[model samples]
Target: MSKTTITANGQTKNLSLEPRRLLADVLREDFRLSGVHIGCAHGACGACTVHVDGVPRLSCLTFAVQCDGAEINTVESLGGDDAHHLLQRAFREEHGLQCGYCTPGFLMTMAPYVEEMAAQDRMPEDAEIRHAMSGNICRCTGYQSIVAAVRLAITQRRNGESTQ
Candidate 1:
């Protein structure tokens, strides 16, 4: 077994895994982070999306051993009484989800992108937002609400408002 240490959510997780164990399996099976779903089990579907070192990655395509010393964030981390990420709130306000299976991926992927845009003092243009989110495919809500959620997040961030 290969041992790896990864910080997930706000906690550190040490895992002993088989060489071929996917990161999604480790997060869900071993660590009990079921929010990182496995959809395609390939890199195509964003259902296994999570943040690694503040960037979105497809956990299904990533091996657990490869995540040694990495910082990972899953959708579960966003839950709490005071937890109010803009995307999460915007999702609710804008009704951005249907069926809800793909919502986690969309939220996790867009969180960093919107935060980056806010840091740069620019909101992503519609085309830019679409292009940036091209990898995530949602079969529900027709994506209009998803786009609205991102826009709302950008607006709130610019206004110095915290969803929490």
Candidate 2:
């Protein structure tokens, strides 16, 4: 077993795990962060997307040991039932999810793009939104609602509305 330290959901943890253990497994099985879903396990699906050091990564393709000393943020870190992030609220308001299996990954993957666009004080075009969201796949909703949700979040952020 290897010892590694990771800050997940704003909480730091030192864990002993197999060197080859996947970050998805560590987050889900070890830490009980069930929002990190493992769908394709091969990283093609992006179902296990998470933020590692403020950048989106495929948790299924990453080793826990590789993330040592990194700050990780899963969907759980975004918000809770009482207070929802703008993206989450937009997703709900726009009906971005159907089965909801892919919502967390989609949220994780699109968050940085939304934040960057907000900082730039611009909303992405439809084509740009599609390009940015190409990594994540959703079997339901046909992506229109997801794109709308992202656009809504970007608009909210640009308007200086609360996003967290």
Candidate 3:
């Protein structure tokens, strides 16, 4: 077992983990953060995406030991002040999620995208938005609502408004 430290959702823990243990397992089993879903176990499905050191990464494809002293953020960290994040509210209003299995991954993946675009004060074309989300696959929604949700968040942020 390799000694590893993972800071998840602002809580830091030191753990003894096997070299082969997937990060997804560590987050779910050790941290008890159920937001990281293991859909494909392969990297094809973005269901296990998490923010690793402030960047989106596939937790399922990563090793716990590899993350040694990395800071991680799961979907649980998405909100602050006891309210859903902008993207989350938009998703609910736009019906971006149905079964809710893939919602966490989508939120994790798009949070940066939406904020970056909003900060730039640039409105991405629908195709650009679709390309950014192409890494994730959701069998429930046809993606129209998903696209709409992202657009909504972008609009809200650009307008200096919160989805609250």
Q: Evaluated with lDDT, which candidate comes out highest? A: 3
Order of models, best TM-score first: 2, 3, 1
What TM-score does prediction 3 earn? 0.96
lDDT, model 3: 0.92
Cα deviation of 136, candidate 3, in Å: 0.3
- lDDT of each candidate versus the true structure: 0.85, 0.91, 0.92
Tens-digit lDDT string for candidate 2 (34-136): 9999999997888899999999999999999999999999999887644398999999999999999998999999988999999999988999999999989
Q: What is the lDDT of residue 125 in candidate 3?
A: 98
Tens digit of per-residue lDDT, candidate 1, span 35-132: 88888998886988998888899999899899999998998876543337777989989999988888888888888887888888797788888887
Q: lDDT per residue, candidate 3, 1-164, as tens digits?
A: 99899999989999999899999999999999988899999999799999999999999999999998899999989875343888999998999999989888998999999989989999999999999999899999999999999999999999998644
Model 3 bad stretches (over 4 Å): 80-83, 162-164
Q: Point out where model 2 deviates above 4 Å.
A: 81-83
